[model samples]
Target: MLTVILYHVIFVIVVYTDTGPPYNAFPQKLNFYYFSLYVIPSTTCFFIVLLSTIFLVVKVRRNQRWRKGTSTQTAKTNDKEDKLVRTIIAISTIFIICSFPTVSIFITQIIHKQFRYRDPYLGTLLLLMFNIGGVFQAISSSVNIFFYYRMSSRFKKVFASLFACRRSGIQGTKPSD
Candidate 1:
């Protein structure tokens, strides 16, 4: 991952040299490379998360059936596992929902070379879509914390403790009278 990130940094530095207003006006080949760089990994991640979530759900259901007659301890473990699986599914679903717009826009732009240039109305619509996709991307990246805090009691405790420590440090105790 670090290597990939470094490569992308280098590539962006090399390709995006013009410090001008029309930043989107890259050459065709560079544009293709940039789109591919974003689209491939995002699409791959989406599919992998989707497939793994499905696999986990199926496995959990099968295991639940097998462990129906197990002891309370085992049932408790299964409950924890079920909560984990549900959290994962929720996260994955959010990812898919959030990423769909960006992915679709990239694919559309790739296939339709004149997507943002063909018609004035169409170009404006595409620009709107692009902005909306950016919003979704931001939401997707940052919303995981909310899910963890809401779904996991352990996460809530740790999160609250972190803030509690900060607040206590900021407000030191008064001296005894």
Candidate 2:
């Protein structure tokens, strides 16, 4: 899959780069490592997801246009399709927003060569940006659970049933006989 290839390519680049000295031993080397492991992956993933999302949106819209004004059933189907596309777009947009700070900070560092020599302020700023990105990334990933529960009645039912089963198991109960 594309994800597999992307990971492989980044791994190779990280391994092949002459990063000099072990990780965290030198501030400069640590900065390079951080950017490689965090920034590059986040940026690449954002673009990959963004492009695919755009392509999928276009395809879904085109299909909608082709099938417009067909039948009541088709209209229902279109509505569901639109909701699914919207959900996907929401998720991808969140990803890009979450990743922007990370990518921008690292790219700025690279452009300015800020990491070539130790600078405590830059280090603090990088850490702050990294933490912010991490928080947003976590939110972006977990928000889909709520979206599924809200957007799809079936998902809501299934999700509720799943938790109900867990609760029953924990209570060691078989509903009143």
Candidate 3:
């Protein structure tokens, strides 16, 4: 319920927020693709992940304190929940770290009323930073697969079995075998 309301608020903000004119990619002309696809989605994911992690961590800790006298099963359940929270934290941290540069650029553009790309060197630097940020975003996404494999035995087993089946299917079907 809270999440739905939060998303609606975010949607309103995303629809109303205007991009600044400083950056070459995102001008004040208001491109729908930029707002709808890139900006809104990026901002929404960042906020949702961040807020969810904070709320979930708080709830989990509160529950732990309240259930201090519970049995071992409750303790195990708390341990599992703690692990899940940690994973969420790790993922959100990586996402924020990767997307920091891009967000910074956007913020800078918003703050500066005039275009900041008059100097060629500054423009080049911003372009490079944007590209580096994109690379980092890709790395962050790819690393989540490794995290899943590391943290979840089920995921690891399924991934391994899928690959093993492919390998066997390729090697086991030789006519000379």
Which one is best on TM-score? 1
lDDT of 3 by residue, 82-134 (tens): 77777777877888888877777666655753424445556777677779989
lDDT of 1 by residue, 1-177 (tens): 896688678767756664243555656655666665676777777788778889988998887777775644465787788888889889989998998997888779779877764467678888899799899989988999999998999999999999999999878877679
Error of 3 at 129 (Å): 1.3
- The 10-residue segment of model 2 with minimum total lDDT is 15-24
Clashes of 2: 0
Show pairs that collide, candidate 1.
none
Residue 95's lDDT in candidate 1: 92
- Per-model RMSD to reference: 3.7, 4.7, 6.6
lDDT of 2 by residue, 1-177 (tens): 797578767765765565544645566555656666666776777788879999999998987886774534455787899889988887778777877776777678768876433567676776777789778878878887887787787989999999999998989965786
| Candidate order by decreasing TM-score | 1, 2, 3
Clash-forming residue pairs, model 3: none
Clash count of each predicted structure = 0, 0, 0
Per-residue error (Å), model 1, residue 154: 2.2
Q: Ten consecutive residues with minimal summed lDDT in candidate 1?
A: 18-27
Q: Of models 2 and 3, which has the larger lDDT? A: 2
